[model samples]
Target: MARAPVRSSQAKVVSNILEKHGYQLGQYLGKGAYAIVWEAYFKKWRTNVAVKVLMKDKAEAEFLSKFLPREIQVWKGLKHPNLINFYQSIETTNRVYIMLELAPGGEVMDKIRMKGACDERTAGKWFEQLCQGMAYIHSKGVVHRDLKLENLLLDQHDNIKISDFGFCKFAATDVKNLKQVQLSETYCGSYAYVPPEVLQGIPYNPFLSDVWSMGVILFTLRTGKLPFDDSNLRRLLKQMIKGPIFTQKHASISLECKDLVRGTLASDVHRYSLHTIFDHPWMLPLVRERPPYLRDMDALYLRPHLRRSTQRLMTIRHTDGGTRSTANLVSSTRLVHPEALRSPSPPPSPPAHRPPLHARPPLQRSWGGREEGGRAESERERERGRGLAKDGRRRE
Candidate 1:
């Protein structure tokens, strides 16, 4: 059955609230069963933010009464650089609005779809950030319960941001006098990422289940495929219960990487803790080179611009004229924001007439070939071009 739409009056009320708060709604970011996300400009702050609008009616009263409050409680207290930043929330007679830090770089799943498989170094960097973010949240007694690729977003700088707190729960509120570790019987998260125990309808440690999801992520990163992919739910569950994830012999990944994947995918009793995963030989190099966390000011300014650029690019790609001349448009955008090159499109082959946006100068290490400076240069050039071409009419 088709879901009911928010009443026109309710939507108008939401628009009024946004405008009253100095936010101008821009483009649709995405939608789910209960909420819709839009890119909006916060005029007062001179920043771009994502507004998640959730409709509240009799049908969704239970969700509004339970999950929404829990989500707000967890999001309001989170301050990690690798987790999505929640600015504030507003409530109305018929709806709720959540203002959030937008990650314009899109989901890790999109990147996987574009590049087939990620190089080990790139995957390691992302994995390290995921571990740090997960560790921070777990320390606060919250278990994410969902840790799939779609829930993992990337910022303009390629940093990971863990999102979607709808299924998040506190394992223990008071750690001082904890008598026993908390366990949850809730069956949540995506089917492919769900741990075997959760599928068996048994009480399980949420933290351990999260670790299993991470293991699935690592496997997908290396192979561009799920470890237990199947259309049949029963067959998939059986595969999850079976030991070992098969890796391609020809794939370029270290044995230590495979070992970590295997260990994280193990049953709850043998699953590695987040700390142990961080200390693993495969993750140690990234740990040693970890950058300082983003300050509040840095995030406040950078996030908006990135989101705006992403919206512009997406809008352009969808136009008929833009579709035909996508190469030039893509190159032009890349000239200004090299990170745009990594957007969900397949890795482009360099045109014979011109150098590709991703072409990099020789570097000291094979794995260090993807240059940050190159991306910065492209972005600068693209901005200049935009200024010069402002008078040109856009193709409809």
Candidate 2:
């Protein structure tokens, strides 16, 4: 695909601006549809950073004008160990530069591709991190419209960092107002990972869609394959809408893990909420084992003037009567503590009186399970009954 050209003048302008701000742009990292990432050295902080440069042209100016700023604003408010850190954004006449943390361990998808599949323990650890990250973002009233293996990067310690906010949007900031906020109907996301509601062209809750995508990721991690896969797009969509994601009988995975997947991939009524997923039998151990909040003291100790100056530049361009901007938008750049980015209290512990895993009733089943055969027969009978009723009505 042809990318927008970064002219020599624009390049020099960006370079001078970075130099003025005590940053040295280094080697090229990667490129996407609208941006190019480069390794950069921040002389002031004495740390390596990833700089994402987005070129602007007349053709895409309007779209970039709205999207780029929203992305910057979203990143500025988010600070979590499992999320990619955003430093600042620099905008010029023809380009926008985003400073971010560099994840040298590369993408999770690459690792999965190399190993085919991961053990349940490893998958559980990664899934915990993914959930924590998602929880943080959702708490901030943002929904990552796209959550897949490819967008998950790893740090040196093998910790997951959720990246790529191009498709993210603010859903709701106030808990009480959640139902009143307009639901998103935009059809966007990777086809293989998209939820049934989205594919059916219904206005869907973005958070639920994100949860579905996470379920897809979990399934991929366990089996190294998509839960719903087919060459024909229509066939794949049909399978997704028809219900049930059949796991291979030979795949060695526990029922608890399968239950989590089924719960997440279930219809809206039966789907597990993000908070509920955290307390699930398969997730409780990993959640309790989460590492302590690793604080970057330097960020908290940033010079007051420097912080104020950055905040002044973080302008949120508003179009339409307060309808376009995210709710609870941080107008003033307050000193964000690591603790402030997360919930003030710890996550709730699982109930002490809960039954052991083996004793509990089977959770919702997607495909092959103890009751799979019975469920299949039941579904067939229901379908036949519906067909006969339709035939009689037509005859009448």
Candidate 3:
């Protein structure tokens, strides 16, 4: 399904609202089922930023009452070199706007599509960064259920910046005297990266499920293809249960690399925890790359063009006490803007002459499906999944 085109009047209304909030809306970046991402320039920060606008009327009740709030809470609590920075979240009656760090280098999956697989060094470097970021997320007790190549974004320096936390949730803890791990029942995330336990309809540790997805990501990075075919759910589950099979394509990858992949994709009991993964022989030797601020300090000091912009980024501090290169301090005490106010009043939408809801085109693919074969294949996969559920498997 495709998103209805934004009418000129609707665009003008959104731009006006953003302009009042100190942002100058630029080009349309992309759109999903109920949200649209736009490129905008922040007057105060003096840098390009991405704004994700979620249409209230279009969003489902579950999203409004559950996932959206969870995403905002988890995103705000996080601050890390490899994680995308969250600046501000604003709500008007008709829409919810989330301001975020702009990653100019685009999605990591796009790179795999254009060039083939990454070499050992390139894959290792990014994977190390991802592990560090995920470790931080777990320490904060947040589990990002949706972990895939498409969600791994890159900045101007080609550094990894994990994005999209729509399905994120805090790890369940014991209600009685102490904190303990609790298994999750929800079946979320892309089918290609989901672990076997999740597919089996059993309560599973989401942390381990995340580790499994990371294995899928690493394998694809090295081999330029999914380890198991996901065109059919029954076939996919069978392959996962049998475990990943090494082919001629995996022959060139180092022994230690193969071991690491195997360990992560292993059944829950044998799988390595994030801490154990960091201590693995394959990961132990790799040096985590320095962030841009530290790595390019000398060059930035020498060049005026780079120094001016870089210094500005380094100066702004989030209230969380971390020094981020690309985030602004959006604390209530520091600044107050009209747009930041969470008023219940509705903002104007397109004029009454706009097309009816049913008359509009269907929505575009959101964060849910993989883009390997584009929309046609995605729709077919959904149909097949529905058929499986009706057949009494009730796979969800």
lDDT at residue 341 of model 3 (Cα atoms)? 18
Q: Residues 89-122, candidate 2: write the lDDT tens digits.
A: 8887777788999888877766765566689988
Q: Per-residue CA lDDT of candidate 1, range 1-396, in tens?
A: 121244467455666789898887776666554566777888888888888888676325556777789989988899988999999999888778999998888878667755566889888888888988877776666788777777788899999999878778787535443223466766655556767666555556777778888998888787666676322334444466564455455257888998999889875655677756776888887784433332211111112222332333334322321111111111111111222223333322333342322342321111101112443345344335433222111110
User: TM-score for all predictions?
Assistant: 0.69, 0.68, 0.74
lDDT agreement with native, every candidate: 0.62, 0.61, 0.66
RMSD of 2: 19.6
Q: Where is model 3 more than 4 Å wrong at Cα?
A: 1-7, 172-179, 289-373, 376-381, 384-396
The model with the greater lDDT, 1 or 2, is 1
Backbone clashes, candidate 1? 6
> In model 1, which runs have C-alpha deviations exceeding 4 angstroms?
1-13, 176-179, 247-250, 288-396
What are the per-residue Cα lDDT tens digits for candidate 3 across 1-396? 122245688677778788889988877777665778888889998898888999999886767887788889989989999999999988999999999999988878767765667899989989998988887776656788778887899999999999988778777463222134555777666666877666655556777888998998898888776776554444455566556667775788989988999999876666677766777898887756423222211111122222333333223312222111211100000001112112232332232342322233433333322232344344444444343221111112
lDDT of 2: 0.61
